[model samples]
Target chain A: MENPCIICVAITGSLPTKANNPAVPVTVAEQVESTQEAFEAGATICHAHVRNDDETPSADPEKFARLKEGLEEHCPGMVIQFSTGGRSGAGKARGGMLSLAPDMASLSVGSNNFPTRVYENPPELVDWLASEMLEYGVKPEVEAFDLSHILKAADMHKKGQIKDTPYVQFVMGVKNAMPVDREVFDFYIKTVKRLFGEDAAWCAAGIGAQQVVLNEWAISSGGHART
Target chain B: MENPCIICVAITGSLPTKANNPAVPVTVAEQVESTQEAFEAGATICHAHVRNDDETPSADPEKFARLKEGLEEHCPGMVIQFSTGGRSGAGKARGGMLSLAPDMASLSVGSNNFPTRVYENPPELVDWLASEMLEYGVKPEVEAFDLSHILKAADMHKKGQIKDTPYVQFVMGVKNAMPVDREVFDFYIKTVKRLFGEDAAWCAAGIGAQQVVLNEWAISSGGHART
Candidate 1:
């Protein structure tokens, strides 16, 4: 069979320290440039999170707009996907970018305890956000922190809120979420295939040491690899 | 809420070697002893695989009977579960011990590629196995290699072959199956809850280093954790 068609490059997501990886982009121009580099690296889709000039996570629509405009100007055909995950805000505030309506936006399927806090997308918020995405013709990339999250995404799909063939992103390696291990990786793919079918597309992002391994697995398994 | 009641201990499963861990039991008596130790270590459920005198994998009814009798003689109250997974021999021959009718027997939900081979449970075999287990009043522990496997298990449940609220086991870390990583674990749990609801009980076993971590998570999350 031909390999899966999509490749998503997550440029400048939350938690990249300048001390750890100086290459992480903090400014809109840097974000755009990084995205361009990924696009040239065989990524047809780009999943992005914007950072402020000071390198902090930002939910500012203006930042998203800047990144979106830059991508449109630099690589017109690339699919620009933005994060609705606030990384530092309430549900309504976290998904503020939904109003901006990019080609795609993230929708976490369920809630789980992160390293020090809980990241939750309440059912009410999920319902509302999903409706808005559908109304605006924006595809929701169901970001699953755990298996239940994929179920939640499936629930949304069944309720006619999310897209029929929703795109899923398996976020691995978060402490208290799922560990970054091969067993967990295999479980996640199996869970996704169980919840969604051949029509659904999946990508994986492993935290820390797992990122490359998960990326390679996704590529080989006919699933998209989101870096 | 009360802590999850189940603790599954996989004692010397089909894989793993004496070279890896000296604790892995080889003989039938050793297997029973280790199983008792695991149960005493807080595992209420024991998943077993019979090995020949030479330490090769064996699905012989006699080995299984010895295991069951040994467990009964040593640890009377502990639940004994057997692997119906025939990694060797003809599929029909794999069910030799089903006549023993232990409390539970694993029914692999679907098939996937392993490191060196492909493990497929054809539909006819699955149906026959499910019917036999049901007739014998043996609870089938639906083993899922991927998401599709879970779906197949669900189908079995709907057909009334498997019991309602079927116990599902997410077998992680097998190549060509789901990887044993945090993200995959999260996806597996979430998917189970989403598909089966909070009423469903699930367990996980991570191959290699993930084993301990999965145990901790399963215990904390109110699910069964098998080593």
Candidate 2:
């Protein structure tokens, strides 16, 4: 049999709000309900970013704790991945929820440009987040915003920063970051195989409209898919 | 005969003070003298950043004007490229010297991590700098710190933000950014050719100890080189 593909669903990202889409889950209860639906639909991993009452992204550990408890009860056996993404918070605040010890957390190993701003991930911050994940026994879903980020993850893994083999997720089609290019996407896969072993697992994610395109590409290319 | 290689000499970068190297040029007069020597020694381009009296990086336009005047008087036809690098200043202050209109200016199309901090080049600031370069009639030498930067340059070119075909410089071996990897180096060249035409000009730059290695690699690969 071929390798089984793990479908990861980002139920609610930091940017999306009720204004953009009414179905975007805002409260902890809504997040758990939405993720349970995704889990029922065959998504084994639920990547989440919690939001405040007014729909602003939040880094509150209290909220994260509640979300974790809810997911554990509602989506039982599904892998819970909290987003340590920049939009929710700044500095170490972004990783404050790592102590909740979710199954996994998204970690950006390097900095890159977003739609309107520079996604500031300093080297010290990256190291600190990786260390936090290590302490909490949280597996990191290495977010590769550009090619160098993959290399950075490899370097970190080699240096004992990342205890296990990094599970890289190639993010493409951001406004000012890596765009959706077939050649670059192929190179990303080749790089992952070259750095990690041939059997190493990897995934890909695309922004907004490119999500479907990337899903097709990843699924057809023998890699896992993220939405 | 093959196309001639354009040797660019970064006489003084943002860092490197007298404590690090006593020979580093700090004042405008010393920079002019150092660049003149480099020009005589087969360097056809001078990449420069001005420093304060205390040897810290400065974005003072008056100093840049004096340096441009000195270089024009001393080196004659050598290409003068002022650096709008992040280390010297923040936001639009980095492009304050664009009105002086040197032959070329170094423009970073995207952001990445430097040794210690996030080298911030926000989207609005990048567009503003590119626009300033266009208004001053100065050709931009796009600095590619990571892979996405090259694609961003191509996108900017298609949008007419960069008036001419971009002359890209691949920068490698920064602590948190792209390292000196031969496979990546070759891929960078291939991507440049694939995006720009096969005949388009490109260059390579390596930091500190990797400088000679990149120069040799670039020279052997038929691309221009910088030190």
By summed lDDT, the worst window of 10 consecutive residues in model 1 chain B runs over B109-118
Q: Please tell me the TM-score of chain B in candidate 1 relative to the true structure's chain B.
A: 0.91
DockQ of each: 0.02, 0.94
Task: Give the DockQ-based CAPRI class for model 1.
Answer: incorrect
TM-score of chain B, candidates 1 onward in order: 0.91, 0.98
Per-residue CA lDDT of model 2 for B84-112, tens digit only, reads 99889998899999999899999999999
Q: What lDDT would candidate 2 get against the real structure?
A: 0.94
Q: On residues B105-188, what C-alpha lDDT tens digit does candidate 1 reach at each position?
A: 888744444554446565556777888888888898988766555655665677798876778888776642466656556666
lDDT of 1 by residue, A1-227 (tens): 45546778888887785776999887889888988887887788888887766777888877888889999998779998888784845667777777777899888655444555445555566677788888888898887765555655665687788866777888877653565556556666776777787555788888877888888887787778877
Best by DockQ: 2
